[model samples]
Each structure stands twice: as C-alpha cells, then as structure tokens.
Target chain A: MLNRIRCLLIKELTQIRRDPRLFGILIMAPIIQLVVMGFATNTDIREIALAIRDNDRSFHSREYIRALAASGYFRVAALPGPVAGDARQLVAGRAGLVLVIPPGFGRQLVRRAPATVQALVDGADSNFGMQGVNYLNQATRLFSARFAREVAVDARLRGLALPAVAAETRVWYNPELTSRYYMVPALMGVLLLVTTMLVSSMALVKEREEGTMEQLIVTPLRPMEIILGKLLPFVVIGFAEVTLALPLMRLIFGVPLRGSVLLLYALSGVFLLTTLGLGLFVSTLVRTQQQAMLIAAFFVMMPFILLSGFIFPVENMPPAFQVVAQFIPLKYYLTIIRGIFLKGVGWHALWRDGLILLAWGVGILSLAALKFHKRLD
Target chain B: MLARAGLAPALPLVTPAPRVWFNPELESARFLVPGLIGMLLMISSVVATALSIVREKERETIEQLMVSPLRSEELVLGKTLPYLLIGLATMALILLLGWQLFGVVVRGSWLLLGLATVLFLFAGLGLGVLISALTRSQQVAFQVAIIASLLPAIILSGLIFPIRNMPLPIQGLSLLVAPRYFIEILRGVILKDTAFVELWPNFAALLALGAAYNLLAAHKMKQGL
Candidate 1:
C-alpha cells in the first residue's frame, strides 16, 4: 500500500512539475498578493482631511487648532469662511472631518465652563468616522489636561484636582495599532485557502476531464490509495507555500512570529487537511474542471473569505451570521494565527482552536475519502 | 470595550455632538449596494464570458469556429454578445433588488448610470475574453478570472477600504483596476446624486479601459489563431 501511494505521489508530482505555468502561479501569486495587500490593509485612521471653522479667533482657539494638527491624525485645512455651508461643502467634497469651534470657545475653557465644539463627520464610511471621533476625543483630553495644569499654576491653586476626569488609552499588543501587523498574518490564511483549494479542487476533475481516470482505475491502487496519492502532492504544495510565505511575513512585512514555529506548522498541517478535503470533495461532485473551479470559488472560497473575520469583524456581523461563521475553518485559523502572531500565546491558550481544527480536518478528510471511494465504485 | 470602560467615567466632562453628512442615518446598504452592483456585473460578465470561450476550446469547437470565415473580431463579438446581454440583465436585476430590499434609490441620472454600467460590463467582458484566450485550460482560465476580478473589486476598489487611506503606491495601483472607477460612478449616481459634469473623468477612464481591454483581447485572438 505504501509503495502504491508513493508511486501515485511520484506521478502526481511529475505531472505538476510538467505544468510549469501553473506551478509558477501557485508559488508567485501568494507572495505578490501578500506584499500588495500588506500595504493596502490599513485600519489605523491617520491624516484625515480636517476642515476647521475657527469662529473664536482667540489665542486658545489657535492653540487648539495647532494641537489638533500636531496630533498627526488630522490635516487641518482651514475653510475660506466659518459658515456651516463651507464646512458642509468640504465634508461633501473630500474632507472626512469638519470641526466648528463655536463663538466664545476660549473664554469658556478659561473659566472652566463647559464648551461645545461641533464635529461634522462624513459618515459614509462609518469605521473611519468612529475612529476619527475617538482620536479627536483623545487629543482633546490631552489638551485639556495641559490647560488644567497651567490654570492651577497661574491661579495659585496647587492642591485642587481638576473638575474634568481624563481618560488615558494604552493600546496593548499592537501599540502603534498598525493594521498591517494584524492583516498580514490573516493574508497568509487567505492565500493558503485560495491556492490550495484551487489546486486540489482541480486535481481529480482534471484527471477525469482528460480521460485518465480509466487508466488510473486499471492500476493496482485501491480507491483510498488513489485519493491519498492525488491529495498528497497538493498538501506538499500547500506546505511549500506556507514556507515561502512565513519568511515574507517575518522579513518583508516585519511581522513577528513569537509562537513556536513547530506549533504553527502543526496547525497549518491541520488547516491544509481541511482546505484540501474541501477541494477534493468539490472535485468528486463535478465532471469538468470548470464546474469544480466555479463551485469551489462561489460555494467554498467566497463564504470562507467573507465570514473568516479577515475584512469584517465577526462580532459586528448580525447574530445569525455570526453563528454561521463558526462553521468556517478559516474563522478558527484566523483566531490561531492572530493569537500566535500578535499576542504570542502558546498552545495553552489556543489548544481549543487547535482541537476544533483537528476535528474538522479529520471529519472533512474522511468524508472526502468516502465520497471519492463511492464515486470509484 | 476597554475604551468604553475607560470613557464611562469621563462621559460628563465633554459631550461630543456628531452629525453624519450625506448619509445622515449611516445606512450600510446605501454604501454596500452600489459596490455590490459593480461586483455582480464584474463576476457575471468576466467569468461567464471567459468560461464560455474556454469551454469551446476545451470541447474542440473553437478550432472549427476559427476555420470558419468569421473574422476574429466577429468571432470575439459573437461569443461575448450573449454574456454582455446577460451582464446587463444581471445589473438591472441587482439594481432593482437593491432598490426594493435596501431602499437604495438612484438619485443621479439613470442615463449616466446605464452608460457607466455598459462601459463597466464591456471592460469586464473584454478582460474575461482576454483571460480565456491567454490560457488553454478551463481550470486555469477560471482561477485567473476569479483571482483577477474578485479580489480587486472587493479590496482595491474602495468598496471595503477608503482608497485615500491606502499607501500612496497602492493608491496609484488602484487606478489600473477597472472596478475602482465603476464603484465611484455607482456610489456617485446612486447615493450622492453626482451630476455628469462632475463624473466625466470616471466615464472617460472606464471608456479608455474598456477600449484597451477589448483591443488587446482582439489582438490576442488574432495572434492565437
């Protein structure tokens, strides 16, 4: 049985080697995608086009505007006039944030009276709008703390705590909160899933389409051996992709892999099992490579990409959709990758994710083998 | 959650009054519908046309058609016209669904929107034909078509992430992607009520891209034959 499997594996590998175009694409596409998408996936809101309508022309108002500009979050472009119309135009055109400091905004702050500043945000993109609001709040609190200290020194009131309570935020794990650090790791999962599924889903169908299945059936190999042999090459290809991508993650993207490399490979082994089984299952259902590719893309790849929490957070999804996401293998892989890459947690924290992935892999591979065996019979 | 936990005590100190402009209610469907329209047109046109051509090749009918008196351009058009109609029909269906299910009414000129949709479909169909001609195998064509169309439409087209926030190089790279312009036209026409005077640049870009793809595919078809 081992000899038969090896002979089949050698045949599969040799055939793959003959198709240099497909082999080259299978290797190069992921690396290029990772680098390109690494630069594109930024969630950190910075350099928001901010149009300021400073009605209170006092020194303090200018100071506030200067402070906002200095925070590196907002590019303060002063509007031609302080009218609501001007601010609205800017927000509509290109500016994401518009700040209107009302009249007497400085005197109220000096006297410790409540001051209201109106912020009109272009909420077409709600995520950016929310992040912009939070950044503004942080900058305002920082400015207010400095103002309170100055007021205490000038007023000769040393012991009194200021009336305003300030909140300080310390972002853990991702201190700079760069999205690439988070997204680059997730890109690995996306790349592996797409490439592996594309390759393996086409595996059996290609044989059937080319009329080679009859020749293979005449060999001494059993159905199980043929299935394993067909899948083994893609598993190797998947691992090769991971090996190629991990260094790109570490060297090119500068993402640190703090967890044991052995553990990551082990988990990746399980993930490859799940994705390849899905591809093999897809192969069994289709007679043509075109059908296999389409079904694998729409039914397998699309749902996995959407619900994997790669782009959209699963928590923010509707409750029913969130429950649906739990069935996706990419969802669990994302948790493991992010935990291992960002938080550097060990198997102690991530063992459950590992176990679920293992169960999924075994269950899916068995189902695929069963289906393929039944098809052969 | 932690940010809110920290801010819970400081809620009384400062009240931030935020008003959203253009989309006052912040309806996601208003934004998602236009992008979805662009995506649907792309998948249906590109994948369908590409697969149709590749299927003919796989079944050994393409050589017979090639040996016929039909010019390569006529052959390309003959193959793509059905998928083009299918693409337009799918676009109309999706637009109708968007209006009915999501309340995303077309605020700008329907003529402009229709023109943009045709131009977008032309580019996508041209790309599909191009992929079909470049690769021999239906599997490779299908994989290439999906990878080429879907990822860029979703990620690089400002459908999910704001293009302005992307790195300058990636932002520049987005200009090469056809759906980026279509998404702009869709959102501008459907949600923002943008006039044609303001949308001429996107129209011109789509036209140029569509012409370029079709011309290249026509050229490649000639070369392949």
Candidate 2:
C-alpha cells in the first residue's frame, strides 16, 4: 500500500514536471500572492488629506486646526471656504476625510454655548474609512478635552466637561495595527484550503471521469488505501506550500517567528489532514470536476474565510455564527497559526485546537472512505 | 410505521439548531465589491476558455489552425476576445449593482474604470488560455481554471486585506501575482479615484504580466502536447 502510494506520488510529480506552466502556477503563484497581499493590507491609514473650512477666525478655531494637525491624523489642505457641501467634494475625491468646524467665533466657548464639529467621511471603503473616522473623532475629542480642562475654573465649562477618565487603548498583539500583522497568518489557513481542496477534488473527479475509479474498485487496495493514496500527495503539497510560505513570512514579511517551529509544524500537519479529509468528502459528493470545484470553492472556501476570525474577530460575530465557526478546521488552524506567530504560544495554548483538528481529520476521512467502499460494492 | 414516518423530519433534529442569519449591508460592502469583480473575472474566463478549447478539440481543427498562415498571437487574441468582452460586460453589471443596490459610487472617471476592467479581463482570459493549453481534457482544464481564477485572486489580492500586513516575503511575492496588481488598479481607479500617474505602475505590471503569460501560452500551443 505504501509502495502504491509512492508510485502514485511519482506519477503526479511526473505530470507536474511535464507541464512547466502548471508547475509554475502551483509553486510560484503563492509566493507572488504573498508579496502582493503584504503590501496592500495596511490598516494603519496615513496621509489623510483633510480640508478644514474654518468659519470662525477666532483663536479657538485656529486652536482646533492646530490640534488636528498636531494629532498626526490629517494633512490640512487649503480651503476656499468652510461649508458642509465643500467638504463633500474632498471626500468624493478620495481625500479620505473632511472636517467642517462651524462658525461660533469662539463665542460659544466664552458663553458656554454648545459647539459642534461636523465630520464628513468617505464610506466607499468602510474598513479604512471607518478607521479614519474613529481617529478623527478621537482627535477632535482630545482637543475639546484639553479646551475644557483649561476653562474648568471659569465656571462656564463646568457643565460641558468632557469625560473625566480617558479610555486608553493599548493594542496588545499588533501594536502597529498593521493589517499584514493580522492578515498574513490567517491567510495561511486560506491558502491551505485552496491548494488542498483544489488538488484532491480534481484528482478524484478526474479518476471518475476517466473510468479509472472502476478499475480501482476491482483492486484489492481497499477503499481507505485508494482515498489515502489519492489524497496524501495533496496533503504533502499543502505542507510544502505552507513551509515555503512561513519562511517567506519570517524573512520577507517581517512577521516574527517566535514559537517552537516543530509545534507549529505538528499542529499544521493535523490541520492539513482535516482540510484534506474535507476535500475528499467534497469529492465523493460531486460527480464531476466542475461540481467539485464549485462546491469546494463556494461551500468550503467561502465559509472558512467568513468564519475563520481572520478579518473580523469571532467574538464580534453573532453568538450563533461563532458557534458555527467551531465546526470549521480553518478556525482552529487560524488560532494555532496566529497564536504561534503573534503570541509565541505553545502546546499549552493550542492542545484543544490540535485535538479538534485530529478528530475532524479522522472522522471526515473515515466517513468518506466508508461511503466510497459502500458505493463500490 | 406511522410513528416512524412522523419521526423522519425529526431525525434532522438530532443536530444542534442552526445559526440565524443577520443580514448587514455594511458588512457585505467590504467584501462584496471586490468579490464581484474577482468573481466576474473567474466565471467569464473559465467558461470562455473551456468552451473554446472543447470546440477546438472536438472539431479537430486545432491541427489545421496550427498549420494556418495566421500567427499564434492572432489566434490567441481571437479566442480571448469573446471572454474579454464578456468579462467587461460582467464588470459593468457588477458596477451597476454596486451603485444601484449597494450605493458604491465610482469616485474615479468612468474611462479609467473601463480601461482597468479591460486590462484585468485580458490578464484573466490569458490565464484561462494558459490553463487550457496545459490540461489534457476540457473537464480538467475547467477545474484548474476555476482553481486559478477563484482563490488566490480573490483572497490573496489586496482587495480584502491591505497588502502591507502580509509578511515582507509574501509582500514581495505578491508583485508577480496578476490579480493583486489588477485589484489595486481597480480600487485606485474606482474607489480611490487616483489618476493615471498614480496608477501607471500597477497598469504596467498587469500589462507586463498579461504579455508574459500570453507569450508563454502561445509557445506552449506551438509545441503541442
């Protein structure tokens, strides 16, 4: 059985070698994808082109503009006038943010009248735009807080005091809040899903389509051996891809490799097995390569991405969806990968995740083999 | 027997209750816009390449085409044109949906958006042809094509994650991936409204990638399996 598996692996290698194009796609494509995703995934947005229409020529209004500039959030552009409509153009032009401080001539502060600063933000790209909005809101509040502190003795500012205690945010794992810091490790799970499922699904359906599965049914190899023989190469390929990606992440992407490499590998092995098992199950359900690819891409890949807590934290998801995410192998792998990469965590942190992955691997693969055996008989 | 029949639907009750759906438009916008473009490129390129390749193989006209006076470059362009057109149409449909349904405005000029869409379609179709040339049968070609089209382009590209967060090595690696460049180009032109000067590098990269892939595909075709 081991010899036959080796033979099948060699056949796959031969096919890969014979097609340089496909070989490049399989081996070189991920390397390129990693580079592209690295450069583009920036959560720390800078160079916010902000236009301030200062209607009030007062020192207080000037103070706000100075404060905005001092906060490192906005680069102030020349404004012809301060109007809500004018700020809309700045946002529409992708300037990212626009601040309109209304005309009170510093009278509101002296008289204790309620003053307002209107922030118009571009909502087209919500992630960055929302971040920009939050930064802007915080900056404006800081300025107001400082202003309130200065006038506390005047009795005019007593009722309009800002919150006494400021909420200090210290982002623990990703200090820089770089999207790559968050995205790259999670992406390892996604890449594994793509490579493993693509290969196994296509290989199985190709056999069925070519009438080779019938011959396999007549052999004494047993259903488990056949499934294992067909899928083991892809699991190895998935491992190879991940192995290549890790160093690339460490050396090139500047994502620190802190944990035991051996543990990371061991956990990834179990996770890859689970992924391969899922792919085999998908192959059994689909009769053709087209159906296999679609089912795997849509049902498997999409859910894994949405539920993996890669982009949005699972805690932020509805309680029910969070529960559903537990069924996904990628969710566990995401935790293991992120924990190892960011927190430098060990077996103590990831034992349950490892167990879950092992269970999934054994259960899914066993069910798939049993179904294949029953079908053959 | 009646009791067993009544228990048939209840057997599914053995599993825990399913999760309820909370439909949020704001949540959908972040992934949906880029996904629409990426999915369009994938669906059009795979179907077009599969149909065209199957036609050539079934008619046995590939050998005749190889011997014809027309250059392989011309033939590839002819084969790819329909897919490229369909992809552009798909782009238009998605853009319309984004605007009408999702309220995503095209911040950049429509002309630039059109140009970017065409280039992206060109790269996607070229990739489809390359996959088509490599596979033995249409089924395998379609499978490979979908794999190539759907995964890396949608997720690996900067569409979802900002590229800076990828490990430095992966960041460098992404320079060669065609869709990563194209997605940036699309977003720059559409969402960011960046001008030609700002977008020139990405456009050049995509065009270079398209040229390189098409040339390799043509060479492979000439040296038939």
**Candidate with maximal lDDT:** 1
Over the stretch B44-161, how does candidate 2's per-residue lDDT look in tens digits? 5654664354446534778888787877778778889877877787788888888786576777778877877777777777777777676665445654665566655655576665
Write the residue-wise lDDT of candidate 2 on A1-377 in tens digits. 78876666676678667756555656566666565555555556655677776777788888778877888867776467435466345423436566666677467765644476665565555665566666777776777667555545443233333223556666576545556676787776776776676667666666786678887677667777788777766666777888899888877678887888999889888987888888888888877665776677668876777777866689887799999998988889999998898889999989999999999999998988887777787
Candidate that would win on DockQ: 1
Q: Which regions in candidate 1 have their CA more than 4 angstroms from the true location? A: A53-64, A80-92, A100-117, A137-154, A157-178, B1-17, B25-30, B95-106
Cα displacement (Å) at residue B97, model 1: 4.7
**Chain A vs native chain A, TM-score per candidate:** 0.87, 0.83
Per-model RMSD to reference: 5.1, 13.1
Model 1, C-alpha of B184: deviation from truth (Å): 2.7
Report how large a share of the reference interface contacts model 2 reproduces: 0.08
Each predicted model: what fraction of the native A–B Cα contacts (within 8 Å) does it retain?
Answer: 0.35, 0.08
Give the alpha carbon lDDT tens digit for every residue of B1-225 in model 1: 565344322221233467776577776767777887887677667777777677777788888988989888887788778777887888889888988988888877889988998899888888888888888777678768877886777778888777888879999999978999999888777776767766789899999988887888888878868
